[model samples]
Target: MSHLQAHAQSATKSAVRPEHGNDVSPHRFCVAPMLDWTDRHERYFLRLLSRHARLYTEMVTTGALLHGDVKRHLQFNAAEHPVALQLGGSEPDALAHCAELAEKWGYDEINLNVGCPSDRVQSGKFGACLMAEPELVADCVRAMRAATAVPVTVKSRIGIDDKDSDEFLQRFVAVVADAGCRTFIVHARIAVLQGLSPKQNRDIPPLNYPRVQRLKQRFPELQIIINGGINTLAQAQALTDGSDGIALDGVMMGREAYHNPYTLAHADQQLFAEDSAVPSRADVMAAYLPYVEAQLAQGTLLQHMTRHILGLYKGQNGGRLFRRHLSENAFRKNAGISVLKDACALADTHASLPPHEQPDDNLRNHA
Candidate 1:
């Protein structure tokens, strides 16, 4: 047996310890920490749509936090509470240090990334490849848990390459959970390391959700959150409401949430059972504008924020006009908040018109 396999067999399984004697924060509905997609602006926009769903920062590498400008990487708007910081690294000490930084920056949780299939992540000795070295992952989790009071969780794939078996995954979880990591977000698919691009890794491999269901059955005390191929609200609902009372604690949506962000409009009332009235899609954008103006005054490029919102009106009338207005004008020199207002005006006009009377948006079909 490999040393990690040897260690996994020897390590004793115990109940995971909570940081500060409290349970990990509820992550019943989460927006995945997509690389370029879930940056601070995108997270803030997502927050406007769902008050109760948890949000995550784009995965920050240990190198970025330890040697790069720390403030730029860690600063987030105060409105984005209940946000987790996802870190990508394999070194135990560096991860521990980064965990400390996350806690100091007021992140609610720290997540280690072991699911990313990119060659860049592989070059760093982390991501999906770490599944083969469960002992090292255990060490990193142990050090991180020791460094901060915030919950230290892990996001990992079911397997990597030819090691895609239930036994391999079970062993990995056994070792990490033994090291005090309680919450696990499993991307229910194999990460084919060699032949596919990162994009293909996300879609080409068939998702084996039943394996994740088996995981919850085996480790009932651990909070298991399932990811991969969950896009629509109905599918999220059916999966969370498993046969009988058996269910995973959460559902995390990635591309679905970004590509059709309006889908999250129903999350608060549905998944969180929140009593407050949900905001309409336009109202969500209206509320988002003040923040946009504030950011513009600070000299950040409008496209940095506007690029993420082009999909805000997906499936709505005049959605194309809204997107076209921003897409064409947002990056212009000194482009102010007027662009957003004018775009919304088009969308609102469509809302008021009768279906037959609404102008043909040829661009809408292409959009």
Candidate 2:
């Protein structure tokens, strides 16, 4: 069967639950919900590279789903199976309604965003600020739980602003867990709500993996997945490998997965113990071509899909040549799948020759 066919057929299949002891859980290696980076096209592309990793949508606000174009926010390619929809907003009724909508649309899971620290999210009284109002977050979780059969989960920080303590995190998680949330993906840092920009909040704040580890020890029943500051394969493996008895359930990678997605090509074998050999860079490009071609035929910009694969050849021999060709031509009116074809041609040539021995003209002299 074709990739598209598998994409369609797998849409209805359920992903393994991300619980400790359920090592079969596909959520062991997830690509986090990055605002613009994990849209449908990007999810579909990433799916080609690792079939086992769970993918998440860019956070769709409750207002966008209820008051704006619902289909536009909720619709996804059939191939992005085991995909979760991350919903933003604090209104219990609105979030519950959106959760119901997500279930109706066949989403595999619904994740509540209590982790974002942006001023925009603060103005709306949700995100990390909700960390201070554990009851309100619990109510939201209760309502969403009442609305869907699929798992209702949350992504949050260890704390926010003045509440950066283990006692504070314990209270917050206890209340939300009381409301029936079993899984919590915690970014192991505090959100500096007042002076810092969201980007600064991501950095500057020291990562406290030990706090998360203590939380796991405190609430062993909860599937606690760690997020934040984990950027490389070795770092990701340390947690997911489960060798140290850390008791954490999973790993949710954001920017690392986006900026260097090729790292995920090995996620299936490492995280899920899949028997298949890891995919080659060329193999991923070849598998993704049909999806890109189909999207382009549907009037989607070539760059819309191609942009996500720019890192496909990252750190490889002829990667610059591949990136230069796609970067230069993908947005052109006449640019088609041929841009990828030519890029792959360069990728293959460089894959064979030593970097110093390879002709410089190949990357610099793209035809």
Candidate 3:
């Protein structure tokens, strides 16, 4: 067996939580509010892997909630408890209205997106541009907090463009803090709004962990969660040394969970030690088969579900074979649980590969 596969196997076995234990407390180690990639199905899949980690929904625009089907957009599985709904808007009223709707939908928290640097988001006068207007963000937070009993939080970049400095961040946090927001999830980087794509915004900007740590130290009473470029369990653990929590998206949740699912399995053991019993890859796949079949019955494409599992066997002996089989067979005319079974067989076959061979990408792109 390869070292990667050996590590995966050991990690999986070590991460398993007992079936009867239901008292494990949920922690703040969370998945970021990813756009388009963290839908209900995806959140359900992630919940299956880590029961105690908080999950975040994709960012829902205020316009969507006020004009669109609020329940359809906000509804999620009961299994996905401790979930936070991320809202995008600059209008305090619209945001408050959306927060009420979110609370009714049973979300545990409401988060304002002030870090996304996408052009579309900019056109809407929201996202990272709000960093330049701290007062507006404060109002939005105040409105949302008053509208609901659940905690209203902010997810923001350290700075943007010419404003990339400690002073800018300090001022930004101070203003938001004045509005009664006790929790801040800071993506530890500056966002270049004028030229970079949202994807590049997440990568091109350098991660300033020290600045974030200082922010936490400065505001000792606030629950500060550090995000950006956190991929491995060790990296997440490292951040927790100084911060209240760690937020990971594409790196650890989407890509890593897909590619190296064992990493997630291990997270239960290493990170949330009280509730460490994670299901094996085969068990996870088996549990998900019914959901996949149900989605297929509703005419949902296989790729939609299979895409989330592409990295499940990464670093295992048959990792490539498993990926190839799922990639090839999942979209077949009558594909069903058998396709997943075949993929699982391949994963089991290659379970002995070395760790270095594992295709785990360290960069998490949430654009």
Cα-based RMSD of the predictions, in order? 10.1, 2.7, 7.7
TM-score per model over all chains: 0.91, 0.93, 0.83
> TM-score winner among the candidates?
2
Write candidate 3's Cα lDDT for 251-277 as tens digits: 223345444555666676766564435
Candidate 2 per-residue lDDT over residues 93-207, each given as its tens digit: 9999999999999888899999999999999888889898889999999999998897999999999888889999999999999999999999999999999999999999999
Task: Give the clash count for each candidate.
Answer: 0, 0, 19
TM-score of candidate 2 against the unseen true structure? 0.93
lDDT of 2 at 348: 83
Model 3 CA RMSD to the hidden true structure, in angstroms: 7.7
Residues 159-250 of candidate 1 have per-residue lDDT tens digits of: 99999888999999999999999999999999999999999999999999989988888998998998999998777776677742367878
Candidate 2 Cα misplacement greater than 4 A, ranges: 1-21, 241-245, 361-364
Off by over 4 Å in 1: 1-25, 362-367
